[model samples]
Target: MAHPALKNAWPIPRRIVQRTRGHGQGFITRLMSPADLGQALKPFVFLDIFDADRAMLQAVERSGGMPIHPHSGVATVTVITQGHARYDDPAIGAGEIAYGGVEWMRAGGGVWHGKEMTAGDVSRMQGFQLWLALPPELENGPAESRYIDAGDMPYAWPAHIIVGKYGDVRSPVPAPDGINYLLVTMRPGESWSYAPPAGHSVGWLALAKGMLDAGSTVSAGEMAIFENGEAPISLEATGSEDAVFVLGSAVPHPHPLHLGHYSVHTSAEALAAGERRIAELGQKLKEAGDRQTASGSVPVFR
Candidate 1:
């Protein structure tokens, strides 16, 4: 017998409605939020795909991966597809992640700290950084972080369940119910299908390598937003190269987004609370020297 969540759920075939090319100097990325298309993909707000080579790596190593920053009222999900990277967080400890690895941080109420992630042993790295808006209750809560290596992630052939459930496998990363995220790689001339769970009407995919043919062509450094429906999406590698991409689907986020300089929340009140908490945490970090400790402490917003 199927669980109540899965029972009576059926796959629908979704169609691509919009396509956008990423923008950047070397490692280009498409900023989806603050755009008209952003309203179509709620819960999931911001997206950036960084494609780095040896030159880029050297540049990042020189300046570090963005100075220490602060965030609240949302969770950030980072997935590495090309090479590897390492992260040292006060609350999450330190770990290295290779291809298919993930770094998940929930800045519930507020949090401040950066310089935790750096290029791995490899000379190059490519990956996606995504932001998911938090619900009201969790908007002003405590912050948390997790670094998951590729092997610990569940997979079946070409598909690795990055979040939510797929087949009998479920991701170890904790997240709210009713969302699914997958990292898929199909061999040349190969094909695949994804059937999202019930109520997950919003669907989208961004390719990191190769190409995908879903009636229309989708290539690297591009994203395809699907029309709302329960339809199972069908995709095939169109070129001689394998296709690597990330797919995300979820029930549309219901509340209007209340945005801050570095935060996102469901309501104005929640956003205010989160910003206040961020200010409070900033002061505490300043009082404690706001520097990495000798013993490697895991800092969290209370």
Candidate 2:
């Protein structure tokens, strides 16, 4: 039997995080907040979409691109759709993240790393970067990293399971809080249904490409937050092009959040400890001659 389609009744207001208003980057990011960053995005904390033309990508590369940076108290999920990203982490493994490939890295205590596009690899380099926050229990757990090749993820139907499970397909990356991430691609006249666990909270959905029809047409770069509802959130492409987007849900862990330089925790003390740990790791890497510059030095949250 086909699972019941999940409906999104309570409308989630759209907040623009990064917009194409700037001259350089051809994409924008929307940071949904007011709800604690970790709780609201349950299992997911931050999301950024990098989409641009080859000229723009080349400009960014010339501008030094993202530098070696540090992160903690969360996991970074990088999904490449158009181009490739070369990533290196002394703590984890290093490799080239190609189109449709996913690099899942846990910055539990802390980790420093860098990512850049290789020369002559001049594709548009479009993709999404999501930050999944760790709950209080595992906020400072062991740090780790994993990569999923384009072929490894499940893309059987119109939807692709990248981080969790959909129907009979499962993701190689284990979700921490019973959460799942699915990328759905719809034909101009087609649609699909998603049956989420009852206990799970209504997750967040972002329209990456094409328009989504559910009483209203949600255009690209917009996001919808689904509250507990009956009907599955449906979509029908309005243009000749196909529609593609990402949806994620998790067992909501509504807890207070403390934002810090390189981590997110329940309290200031925990955040301090996380930073201290990361500093120590940096020192160790330096001593071992394995330290590398990160993409960006600015802390994500605070």
Candidate 3:
């Protein structure tokens, strides 16, 4: 039997950044939060959903794909819902990092690495990748990376805590920028409440599957952004089946966004610096015979 749909009285309108319209090849749908929406919301940045298939994963594996990408002044959070991924970092450790896990890589100063999923296990590859802008002080620190196993994270009756502090249960993932990330799975007819920290400017909810009956019904792939006001915001499942979603809140820091070939920074100058770093790294890889054939057909952004 289908579960009852979730319902909430205060339905906030979600401003879609842009809907992605393709399959395979790193296609992503972006949703701008209050931080990226305007000056009122700063610090949160944006959320991106990247989906891959069996063919795509194989391509990434063959080409040394994603080729030691670089990032600075931001924290990239990757959570794999389906399939699996392996992260091999000389600085950290090595080996396959499976799905349902989280990788929080901070490109404070700068860093380069490649990531790909295990071949032949792409039954379903879905996940959300979030970009959280760092404050000026920490944005230029040394690069760091941490992996959190799904089983290690704390969870309660209605929600799975991924990062930051929730109620009295704090996540194992460190939040250098004072952000909160929670992945909740709600059974039909069940409800959960979350009270975010004061001064936090942004709150976002993304529906993975099933119906979230808050102010309105949200189905798969829809993201809902909320303003600061209410505490303990409630979420209830509206459909006959269980619903899975991700919710996050953070203190915002607004700055000019400059896009580069493989990174985002506060200014064109920073982007240029990042490009130089990437170019030098690429040269080193090539000299070391580390260059692998390009995988899939994802466009290389410049």
Candidate 4:
């Protein structure tokens, strides 16, 4: 579930007027990528929703799956909604990310992590991993990571401000400016709305579970990119099951996206610099060799 954006042939971006049902790769679904959907929504780039049951979790544990990976020029945000996870970090120490919790890592200059959070004692693990394109200033700066629990997270009614300001609530994460990311849950027949801040013209959300209505039906596993507008995003849970989703808005990124295997930057030179740093870390990671904990899992590397 910690995979990067697929480096497949970049396709001509189809203007997503409203919604899209993205393809699935086993437990993870690729909702948007930097190549297509991301062209219209920058700063807010790639997105994936992962839903794995207990059985799948055990399988991964046995195989030591999801090998360590490198990234730069982007910050990865992982949020859990269904179950929990156990983190074994050398820098931050041990912790747990349960329902509504978040794991944020800014792969500024370069970073290599994937095994930091192993499967926990839960029946299912479900949530999202969003890759936010870093601005010029931070894309090649120092790396940072934060694992915050649900109780400590800032919350407003029906939503958790995952990485930005919401009304009087503001996220603790030092995310770049001009971005607002949120996780929302609504019970059956419940209603909610999101009023974007000025200049935050880019708006979108991927439904995690249950059904929703935003003037149109948005089923589970679907992503909807709202048309450019300043009006509030009116929403409601339509069916018996509760609705949960992650929504984001940002001031459109002004730079042209420069792509790499596990990095994204605003210029070719920046991308090259990030890749070089990743190569250097890959060697160090090799030299460090098998630093897996007694728990039989490896921690993140930078």
What's each prediction's clash count? 7, 16, 19, 0
As for TM-score, the candidate ahead, 1 or 4, is: 4
TM-score, one value per model: 0.90, 0.79, 0.76, 0.93
Winner by lDDT between candidate 4 and candidate 3: 4
Q: Candidate 2 residues 1-302, lDDT tens each?
A: 44445334433333223222112234545344323444555567667776877787677668876665677787878776566766544444456676556877778878775442342265566677788777776678777777667777777577667887766778888657477787777878786556665555556677767877755666777666666433355556667777777777777656666777656676677788788888887776666652333632222211
RMSD of 4: 9.1
Give lDDT for model 4.
0.88
Q: Go through the candidates in order and give each one's C-alpha lDDT.
A: 0.80, 0.64, 0.63, 0.88
Q: TM-score of predicted model 3?
A: 0.76
lDDT for each residue of candidate 3 in 1-302, tens digit (9 for 90 to 100)? 34435344543433332222212336456655323452334455657666677776667667755544666767778776556665544445444434446877777656665442233355557677777766666665666678777777777656666778777888877656467887788889887666678756577687767788765677877777665654556677988887877887777656776655446677677667666766765666557653222422221111
Model 4: per-residue Cα lDDT over 1-302, one tens digit each: 43345533422221236688778987989988899898899988899999999999888877877978999999999998789888877778888998678999999999999988887888899999999999999999999999999999988988998998989889998899889999999999998778888888899989989999887888999999988766678888999899999999999999999999889998999999999999999999999977888765577788
Candidate 1 vs candidate 3: the lDDT winner is 1
Residue 86, candidate 3: how far off, in angstroms?
2.6
Which has the higher TM-score value, candidate number 1 or candidate number 3? Answer: 1
Candidate 3, position 88, lDDT? 46
**The best candidate in terms of TM-score:** 4
After TM-score superposition, the amount by which residue 152's alpha carbon in candidate 4 deviates from its true location, in angstroms, is 0.8
Model 1 steric clash total:
7
Judging by lDDT against the true structure, name the best candidate.
4
